[model samples]
Target: MFTGIVEELGEVVGVTPTAQDSVLVAVRGPLVTSDARHGDSIAVNGVCLTVVDVDGGVFTADVMGETLRRSALGTLRAGDPVNLERAAALGSRLGGHLVQGHVDGVGEVLAREPAPRWETVRFRLPVALSRYVVEKGSITIDGVSLTVAEVGDDWFSVGLIPTTLALTTLGTRAVGDPVNLEMDVLAKYVERLLGARPADAPVPGPVAS
Candidate 1:
């Protein structure tokens, strides 16, 4: 698991196609790759990718066909900047929110409104994922955990401060650019649990031990 806190802004160095429509991507992240070894999980732009090799502050991982179609990682080319975060260790500070590095859907940058202190960026939400987004709720866009400043039926806006704008890829995201989106995992779990129970199911009372 990850905290959605970006440790470094990495760059895609290479992309090579392998068998079964999988592409091996090498990213340069001096910080994240400092101690990375084979099999370590690194989140590249919100997608959890396993480290296959690490050499000279660069790590390579394989992206399968399913991930390519689901998120914007497939559109990445050499020299493109990517958000990089290493997996969370036990007992670490919870800086952002619980980010699984699992991209649920891809969204597009709709518009950006700049303010003196911060910028409000709006993204087009997928119809299927729209119900899960709530005002003031947490959302992960391209691996950066941000709060929902405003919400509409098909879109949500987030306020990015100077730190975020300077550290992450969202700072330079242009209109119509695709982004990996992961809604609150807790909300999805709640919906799943509610849907699993029968309509007439009774709520059991607490039992005294």
Candidate 2:
């Protein structure tokens, strides 16, 4: 699990083919690697990846076919910047929200409107995941937790302050760029618990303690 707080802006140093579809990603992030060991989970742009090896400030993680097909990570090339965050430790303050580092789907930046203190970015939501997002709800984009300011049937927007713009990849992202998106975990859990049966469907069995 993660807090969706970006610790460092890392760069993709290299990508080597591991198998027919899996690729080994070599990333360089001094802060994230300072205490990283083999098997440590590091979120690279919202995708939880286990460390396979560490050499100096560089670490390698395997990207399977599903991850590649579901996120913008596949579009990354050598030298591309990526958001990096270490897994949250127990008892740590949840600075942001509960981020599983699991990318549910991908979205595309539709527009960017600059403000005096912040910028509002609008993204076209993928149809499959649109039902989970809500206004004022937490959402993880490229591993950084943000609140949805507004939501439309097919789009949503977030406000980015200077710190976010300076520290994360979203700062330089342009229109049409693909981004990894993860919706609120709590919302999904609630939906699953409450939406188990149809409204008109009769309940079965007795309640258990």
- TM-score (all chains, Cα) for each model: 0.97, 0.94
- Model 2, 1-209: lDDT tens digits are 99999999999999998999899999999999999999999999999999999999999999999999988889989999999999999999999999998899999999999999999999998887888989899999999999999999889999999999999999999999999999999988988977986888876878899
Model 1 stretches with alpha carbons more than 4 Å out = 204-209
lDDT of every model, 2 decimals: 0.96, 0.95
Report the Cα lDDT for residue 147, model 1.
95
**Which 10 successive residues of model 2 have the least lDDT summed?**
196-205
For model 2, the superposed segments whose C-alpha errors exceed 4 Å read: 198-209
Q: Pick by TM-score: which candidate is best?
A: 1
Which pairs in model 2 have colliding backbones? none
| 1-209: candidate 1 lDDT, tens digit per residue | 99999999999999999977789999999999999999999999999999999999999999999999999999999999999999999999999999999899999999999999999999998999999899999999999999998999899999999999999999999999999999999999999998999989996689999
What TM-score does structure 1 among the candidates reach? 0.97
